[model samples]
Target: MNDRLGRLRDTTINLAHGSGGRAMRELIEDVFVMAFDNPALAALEDQAVFPLADLVRHGDRLAFTTDSYVVDPLFFPGGDIGTLAVSGTVNDLAMSGAKPLFLSCGMVIEEGLAVDILRRVAASMQRVAIEAGVSIVTGDTKVVERGCADKLFVNTAGVGVVPAGVSISARRAQAGDVVIVNGFLGDHGTAILVARQQLALQSDIESDCAPLASLVAAMLDTREDIHCMRDATRGGVATVLNEFALSSGVAIRIHEAALPIREEVKGACEILGLDPLYLANEGKLVAVVPAHAAERVLAAMHAHPAGRHAGVIGEVVAQPAGIVVLHTGFGGQRIVDMLVGEQLPRIC
Candidate 1:
């Protein structure tokens, strides 16, 4: 592994930086390779190689997923695009009750982007990858004209091993199951809105962007019988509940009173005429577990830092299958449908 960070002569990215030549090599070696130092990455091979036996020890099946991130503002209060890229991919693999292991990062950089900014982003990715217990084994990079692309865009693909006897899926939700969430919702969305618009709102809402594999591991340790698990990302909890309902052919009813939302996020949503339920949450997850295991799982979630504000928001029902209903605090009920349009674009 490259123990020393590589230094670049250029202050900003240029077309030459993306060219498959000396500049590109320096960028890869000095920035990405140094930050994500590992044997597989440091080898500088065309592809990352791993021992099949290493994977077999974890499980018989492999879970793979990929996602792209292009948040309007690369940097946010709690995290940057680099952090979001790694955490998002890791969380996707963890939703399947898999132990995340490896990731591949791809970046599309715009010409004139500050070299320092790219380095900062790379450092963020490495920090989050370490926290998620994953290695960045391979990656690709490209540079586009200044106006052709945003300042930067990141794509991350991840692979993990699903342990034996663990089968968690959205379609596994069943009637009489309970829904639980890890931590507050809508903070990511609210934070982006505030940052993008430069809103002078007095709020402490920072993007709840985090890697949730550890929290998921804690939950599985407490109860491997978890039925459904999904990180509430772009579409938030409302979208995840609807997916569970549709996939399992069951009804999911959540109580507004039971939701765990921060006062700052709630107030921001109200001021912006937004529904916190549909706001994005990078760090939160909606889990459906057997009713009997709900309390134990919630207790386990509470024990983890990521799930400190975990709560049992609702449960599944037999009637009105393929839909999600929300019991309002105002002594009324409403159907929480999927988001009609993009509420906040470029939000991870």
Candidate 2:
């Protein structure tokens, strides 16, 4: 049996691997279980069991979020589906000022996928989960026939505990709030596009796919009065700002010069006639904080690696509620509204 399972490691996935038979058990035990080794996961139970007392020590509220990753090619410059699965959900929890505790991974893998590929992805997930100080406590795997699914797709659901007295919501933005972003924007979307090789473009840009829990923790430590926070994922900063504006019934105005966009990303956007504001970001976040805490938060963010490029980009206003405005570098002001349609598909 050991020899058979060892041989399976060098081979490819087949329908039997998902049949809930010996093959399925071997795959799970050899690949996922070994990679994500932890007491909660080692029990091999249907659900991860945690003591209620262990959870309540962190906070009074619970933060739960889930996200799916189907980025074409599976592997990109900076990360893969596994990395995305962990970071995406972890970021979601952190956006609520929660301390991410555990994650559940769900994978839909196509038949004939190289076992080595699966191992690599599982390893990536473990590594990122460790970096984010979280555990992969439970998961499920399914192998579909070739062409029935993409090469690989990952879904992750995360659970965290929100600290007491920390209240973050989209509707918390106020007129005197200041907007800030962590690091560069649009690298993830642009990197995926370039990786497709359809545009025949060349650049050294890499996706900013990283877990933001620590960065958020540092910001929260600086001050817990952060009004609103959201990872600029699918619709980028523009979408998040729009959501905040509409939810809080306030207008947001951002400065173009202050926007932290890479030159390579800007060049790609100009050629494709795309707006960097709408491009997706994996590691970036939009934070609406009180004006007084802006500098302090920015300083704290700069002290961390993930937020080294943090900057104050915009501020909330009273008039024109539910609108986002941009101060163009050309000395013109324009309304930056929600993205009309998909700018880049299969990104993040």
Candidate 3:
């Protein structure tokens, strides 16, 4: 049986692996379990049990988040769905000023998928988990008819500890609060777009998919009173700003020239007739802080690798509540509204 499992390691997935029989057990034991080995995971049980003492030591609140990845092409220049799955959930927890602790991965795969490819993705997920100081403590696998599902899809749910006395929320933005972004926008969306090769365009752009817990920690260390934190994912910074504005009942004003965008990303957006502000990002974050703490938080962000391109792009305003306006480079102002239609789909 062990020899059979060993031989199957390098093979492609078949319908039998999802049949809830010996083949299924062997597949789980060989692939997911081995790749994401941990104390709770090694138990090979249906649920992951954590020590209450451990949870209480770091925080008084629990942060939980779940996200699903159905990105096309599976792999992009800088990251794949594997990294995105882990980073996406981690970033969600981080946005609440939490210390991400664990993740549960659920995979929906099409029959006839390559075992090697699944192994590679599992390995990538493991690597990213280690880098982000989290663990995949539990998971499930389901194989569907080949044509009914995409080649692969991943869903991740994560839990983290939010330190006592710390509060972060989109609704916390206040007038005079400064808005800061950790890095370039549109990189992830553009990278995925180029991967599609629909426009016959090419660029050196790559996805900025990464974990933001460390950067968040750095900022919180300096000042836990930072007003709000959000990962600019599906809707990009503009959309996030709109959300914050509506939630907090405050307007957001951003300076176009002050926004940090990579040249390659800018050129790609120009070519695609897309606005960078409306594009998606994976590793970037939007932080709002009181004017007094803005400089300190910005400094802390600059000190972190993930935030090297951090910039103060805007501020919260009192008038015209629930709106986001951008100061254009040409000395004109325009409303940056939530995208009415999908500018780019399945990019995340």
- Cα deviation at 111, candidate 2, in Å, is 0.9
Clashes in model 3: which pairs? Answer: none
Compose the digit string of candidate 3's lDDT tens values, residues 119-177.
Answer: 88899999999999999999888888879788999999999999988899999999989
Q: Which residue runs of candidate 2 sit more than 4 Å off their true CA positions?
A: 1-10
User: What is the Cα-based lDDT of residue 343 in candidate 2?
Assistant: 86
Best by lDDT: 2
lDDT of 1 by residue, 245-347 (tens): 9999999999999998888888888787889999999998999999999889988889999988998999999879998999999989999998888888889
Residue 196 CA displacement from its true place in model 3, Å:
1.2
lDDT of 2 by residue, 103-211 (tens): 9998898999999888999999999999999999998889999999988889999999999999999999999999999989999989998899855688999999999
After superposition, which runs of candidate 1 have C-alpha atoms over 4 Å from their true positions? 1-7
| Candidate 2 global lDDT | 0.92
Off by over 4 Å in 3: 1-10
Error of 2 at 243 (Å): 0.5
TM-score, prediction 1 = 0.97
Question: TM-scores of the models, in the given order?
Answer: 0.97, 0.97, 0.97
